[model samples]
Target: MAPAITLAAEAPKLSSANTGFMLICSALVLLMTPGLAFFYGGMVRVKSTLNMLMMSFISMGIVTILWVLYGFSLAFGEHNSLIGWNSDWFGLSHIGLTELWPGYSIPVFVFMVFQMMFAIITPALISGALADRVKFSAWSLFIALWVTIVYVPVAHWVWGADGWAFKLGVIDFAGGTAVHINAGAAALGVILVIGKRVGFKKDPMRPHSLPWVMLGAGLLWFGWFGFNAGSWLGNDDGVGALMFVNTQVATAAAMLAWLAYEKIRHGAFTTLGAASGAVAGLVAITPSGGAVSPLGAIAVGAIAGVACAAAVGLKFRFGYDDSLDVVGVHMVGGIIGSLLIGFFATGKGQSAATGVFYGDHTFTQLWKQCAGVGAVLAYSLVVSAVLAFLLDKTIGMRVSEDEEISGIDQAEHAETAYDFSGAGGGVVGSVSASALATAAQTKKVDA
Candidate 1:
C-alpha cells in the first residue's frame, strides 16, 4: 500500500542567527499589542480606559487561537490568487521541528509566530476608533470575525506566496497596505455605521492621562523596530539594517513635523502632538523603509505628520467619531507611505522596483501601489461595515446610554483603572482620589 511513507526532505538549512533574531523580533512585536492597549487606553476618557485597553488586549487572545486553527493556512498556506487553504498545517498539527520555511533562514514555527504577531496587532488597531461605545461582547465577536474575513484575505493578497499583489511586484516591505490601511478603513466603516460617540462635538472628552499616553507611545516606538526591521525575517541582511535606520529617522522627523504643525495651527506644541506624530511617522515609514533612503523616510514622515494632523479634524467636518484618530493616522499615513514608494523607491534596496523620481517616469509602480491600497481599503471597509451592521442589529454593538455616561469600565468589567477608596494620604493617594473624584463629579454633571 504505502511505499514506506517517505517524508520529503526539509526545505533548507536553518540559520541559527536568523532564528534567534526572529525569536527576539517575535517577542518585540508581541509587545506592541499591549503597547497599543495602553496607548488607546490612555487616550480615552478615564471612565472607558479599561474598556479601551480590553478592546486591544482581547485581539491578542482571539487572533492567536484563530491563527492556530485556520488563519495561518488561509493567509500563508498553499495558494490561489485570492487566498490559500491548505489543511496540512491547520491547528499547527504537522509542522516538524527544525523544519525550515522554503527558501527562508528561519524555522517554520518561528516564522509562524512572527506572522501571528502581525495578525494580532492588525485587529487591535481597530479598537482605537470604536473606543468608548462598543459592547465588550460584541467587540470581542467583531475581532474574531473581522480578522478572519478582512485581515486574513487581505494578508493573503499582499503577503501570501500566490497573493495577487505579491505576484504583481507590489513592494510592501512591511504592512503599510495590509495592516495599517486595512485596519484604518475598517475603523472608518464601523464608525460610520455605529454613528458618532454620544457627544458628537459638544463634549470635552479629552485624554485623562497624557503621562500614560507618553508611556504607551514610548513602548510602541520601542516595539516598532521589530515591526519594521524584522519583516525581513532575518537581521543578517543589509535590508533589515537599512529598514531599522529608516524607522528611526522617519519617526523623529515626523514628530518634529507634527510639533511644528500643531504650533502653527493650534498655537501650542502639546505632548499629545509629539506622541501622535511619532506614531504617524512609524505608520508612514512601514511600507517604504526597505525601499527608500533615510532622507526619503524623512520626507514621508514629514508629509504624514502634516497630513494626519489635519485629517484628524475631518471627524468634526463630516461627523464620524473616530475616537483616537485611527482613520487619520494609520489609514492616511499608510496611504501616503504606500503611494510615496512609487516616487521614492530607488530600485536599489531589497525591492528592485524604481519609482518615478528614480528615473522611472512611467508611474507603473505607483499604479500597482494604488491598486494594493485601494483593494485592501475597499474590501476591509465593506466587510467591516457589514459586520458592524449585523452585530448592531442582532446582539447590539454599543453600550447603553446610561452605561456610556457612567463609564464603560465599571459598566462592562466591574473594574476601575484606579481605586482611591482604599489608599493612604500620600501623593499617590491624593492624585488618584482627585482623578477619580473629578471623574465622578463629571458623571454627575453629565447626568
Candidate 2:
C-alpha cells in the first residue's frame, strides 16, 4: 500500500483543462479533412467532383485504422532517428489511461489521436494533384504505402523526440515539411510518372463550384487554430496564444497579397485566388507561427501568397499537369514558410533560436531550414515517383481515357455529386446510357 501510494504521489497530475482543450483541437483538426474534401472537390470539373471528395474522405478511413495498428508506433514510438517503433505501441494496447505524455499534461492517447489527424490529412493533400484521372483503388493503395514509407519517417524526423531533424534544431511548428511539402512533392512525383491528364493544356478545366471552395476555405481557417495553437500541446503559456494570433494575421495578409497580385497580373481578382491565397498564407504560417511575431507572419504570408500565385502558372510552362495546383500551393507555400523561419524567428517563442533578421548573423538557421526542406523534397519526390511508376506499370494508376472523359465518378464510384434527373437536366443519371456515352464522346471531341 505504501509503495503504490508513493508511486501515485510521484506521478504527474493530469490537467483536465489541457486534456479538454486538446480534445477540442483534435476534433477541429479532423474537420479539416472534410473541409479539404470540399476544397478539392469543388476545384475539379463536375464530372470528377465525387471522386475528388472520395479521395480525401478515404484517407480518413484508411489512416484511422492504420494509426491504431502501427502508424502511431512508427511515427512516435521510441526507436532510431529515421523511424520509431515499440511493440507495446501497436494497437495502443500497452499505454496506460493515466500515462501522460512525457513533460506534458495530456495523456498519450490525446496526443496520439491529435497526431493521427495530421497523418490522415497529409496523404489526402496529395490526391488534389491527381484529381480527375487516377484509379480510386490505386490511389487508396498509394495512400497506405505512402503513409508507411514517406509520412512516418518524415513525421519522426520533424516531430519525434529523437528524430534527427528535431535534434538538429529544425523548426516545423505544425507541418510545413512533414505535411504540406511532403504532399506537394509526392503529388509532383506521381504526376510525372503517370504523365499528363488526357487533354492537358488544350482543355478548359475550370473549377466546378466556387461556393464549395469558399466554404472549404472558411472551414480550414476555423480548424487551423487547433492545428497551429494546439501544437503547443498546452495553453499554460503565451506561446499558443502567439501562434493563434500569427495564424490569423498571416492568413489575412496572404489573402490580400494574393488578391493584389491577381489584380495586377490577371486584371481581376477571383474567388479561387482568394481561397488559394488564404491557404497559402495558412501554409506559410504553419511552420513559422511558433517562432515569428505577428509582423513576421505578415511577411511570410505575403511572400507565400505572391510566390505561390506565380508558381501555379509554372505547370503550364513546364508542361506538367497538376490537376488542381497542389504542387504550386502546398509545395511552394511550405518551402516559403519553412525557409522564412530562418529570417523571421524571434528567439522567444517556442524555441530560443533567432533568425537572420533577429540577431543570428551567421545564416545558420536558414541553412538548417534549407537542409530540412531539401531533404524532404528530394526524398518524397524520388520515392513517390518510384511508387507511382511501380503502381503504374503493375496495377495502373489512371483510369482508361474513356472513363476519364465519361467521368471518373461513374466509372470509379458509380455516383455523382448532384442529381439532375428530377429536373430533366442532361447530367449523368438524367440521360440514358447511350446518351451519356455520346456526351462523353462529345467532350472528348471538344477537348
* Candidate 2 residue runs with Cα over 4 Å from true position: 1-12, 423-447
Worst ten in a row by lDDT for model 1: 1-10
Off by over 4 Å in 1: 1-12, 424-447
Per-prediction TM-score to the true structure, in the order listed: 0.93, 0.93
lDDT scores of the candidates, listed in order: 0.90, 0.92
**Candidate 1 residue lDDT tens string, 1-447:** 000122357334689999999899889999998998888888999899999888888888999999999998899886697988878789999999987776676788898899999999998999999988999999999999998999999888888888888888777888999999999999999999998877869989999998889988999999999999889887655999999999999999999999999999999999999999999999999999999998999998999999999998998898889999999999999999999999999888876799998977889999999999999999999999999999999999999998989989999999998875654347677887999999999999999
Alpha-carbon lDDT of model 2: 0.92
Quote model 2's TM-score: 0.93
Model 2 residue 168 distance off true place after TM-score fit, in angstroms: 0.3
Local error of candidate 1 at residue 328 (angstroms): 0.4
Model 2: per-residue lDDT, tens digit, 1-447?
A: 000113544665689999999999999999999999999988999999999999999999999999999999998876888999979889999999988887777888999999999999999999999988999999999999999999999999998888888888889999999999999999999999998988889989999999999999999999999999999988887999999999999999999999999999999999999999999999999999999999999999999999999999999999998999999999999999999999999999988999999999999999999989999999999999999999999999999999999999999999988877666565455457778799999999999
Residue clash pairs of candidate 1: none
Residue 121, model 2: lDDT of: 94
Alpha-carbon lDDT of model 1: 0.90
